[model samples]
Target: MKKSLFSKVLFVCLIIPSVLTQAAEVNVYSYRQPFLVEPLFNVFTEKTGVKVNVVFAKKGMAERLAREGQHSPADILLTTDISRLVELHDKDLLQAVDSETLEKAVPEKFQSKDNTWYGLTMRVRNIYSSKRLGQVDLSYEDLADPKYKGRVCTRSGKHPYNVALVSSMIAAHGEEKTLTWLENLKKNLARKPQGSDRGQVQAIHQNLCDLSLGNSYYFGNMLNDEKQKVWADAVNINFPNQANRGAHVNISGVAMAKHAPNAKNALALMEFLVSEQAQQMYAETNMEYPVREGVAVSALVSSWGQFKADELSLETIAQHRKAAIKLLDKAQFDL
Candidate 1:
């Protein structure tokens, strides 16, 4: 009887731990690449003892989340780009959580109006110019200069970054003036806007275009690649519109699924992410700026120097997105 009671107690101890482990697990579906977001997950699991199950897809996370609905097992949604985040909110797939931590870490412009989503990291649309040249002129309007005609390269205008940049112009000017700018800008492209932003930098090395518009991180990432390093090394990265409203910027952020299976765990993870440790990892690894104040920018990013970012509430950017996209379509900015 003594041995029997001892065995039963031991069994209970083992099974209880397993049950508790299962209870703490959070299932996440992320639009960000695995490498980009998994580190944050690992850190969260380490700190909270919550196990994470992740499903990574390059696109269609929104549709998948919608299809899953209340039956969905996803407790968290992590993605890049504002449009998709806005889409999920519009679809009613996100739930608002009252986290004072998130509010303190993220700015009002970088989060959803209802707190359904929150921005984690920020990036800028910047100009890359030749260092061999005299003084660098940093202005978005410089692309329209006749000297830059046939010397400008960029990624797809249909891309969200470009769309946001164009949207900023539309906000500053108006639809008619923004359309004319794009029309002339497209005519001046050295070659058609093709390939990724990195491709635009490569065009700079090849002398295909004297100036290119691309994400700030691409410049840092290229510093590690052999062939690409040549392109990145030869150029000077500049933040345009410094004396004016500054460069166009966007953010990569997160939200909790409306029917989070592990709502508590999801909130804990969000809190951990905005913490300084995770924000540092986010900035150093991704070459992005932490949304929180006083976290130093990455060395690579800082080297490019600081410039103003359009202070338009990011929500305004999202609000104008549909109109901006319509203008792009009308301007025939396909290339």
Candidate 2:
């Protein structure tokens, strides 16, 4: 019998998998910068004999996957911010991951209540003030004070970081109260909201403002980066709302794709990512807090000293997002 071209092609395709099986691989679509997340993938492959193929983009990974649907090639979604992950989950794009290692590695405060997403690191919204100004009672709410008028600086209120913080405020307070607070805060701005959180710190050092809001990691990076040392040396770090429940917090998190082609491997990767070693890398390298309980906070972070973190579930922050954005607009936060 003569062999058909189609039969030969199909036979080769079937055998190619056995040839490729010698090397296990995983594909990741990440909204995080490659330098920040690639190191972990390298670490994962080293320990598990799995090679990771990554595609990093600043935005649109979610939309790309949603467009691709079950045909999506992404095995995992790595991102920062609770809102993004929760949005993915709400859209039914993420599948629940019930790994014991993940549950043990991440605390309840950091991970999704439904186990749809797992937090790998934590960020705290913090305040930075001039040491020259001396002791200060800093609070996110205090940003609204009349005394700080023309002495306050911040990134644009529309930024996700600020939006999430505002969301938390709404949950803590209410729509009416949040609107009032944002209006007062707008009146105090040294300059219209502009620049990255780090830029706000730079403005303070330049004497452009007496205070600014930043993520705790920005302080750590500033303190360590040679380029930012002068700005870092000039300020004192203050954790907001210590007198109340605590400062609002956020996280860098991960989730399995709804149709993960490599579900078992992805679960393994998720578990490994929350391990002590990975958490330490997240804390030390990124200047983020470890999601796990016993891991020591990074030395750089610790030097800033300890303060309370808001105990509210992060999901509540996601839930209040719309209300916060509305309040932001109604209060003329941009003004």
Q: Pick the candidate with the highest lDDT.
A: 2
Residue-by-residue lDDT tens digits, candidate 1, 1-335: 99999999999999999768757898888887777778888988888789889998878888898898789989888878787788888889999989999998899989988889999999988898865664696788878777778888988888878888887888888888888888888878898778998988888888787888988888888996887899998788888888888778888889999999789888888898899998988888878889988888888778877778888877777877788888888877774
In model 2, the Cα lDDT at residue 182 comes to 91
* Best TM-score among the predictions, by candidate number: 2
Q: lDDT per model, in order? A: 0.85, 0.86
Cα-based TM-score, every candidate: 0.91, 0.93
Residue pairs with backbone overlap in model 2: none
Question: Which parts of model 1 have CA positions greater than 4 angstroms off?
Answer: 1-22
| lDDT at residue 294 of model 1 (Cα atoms) | 83
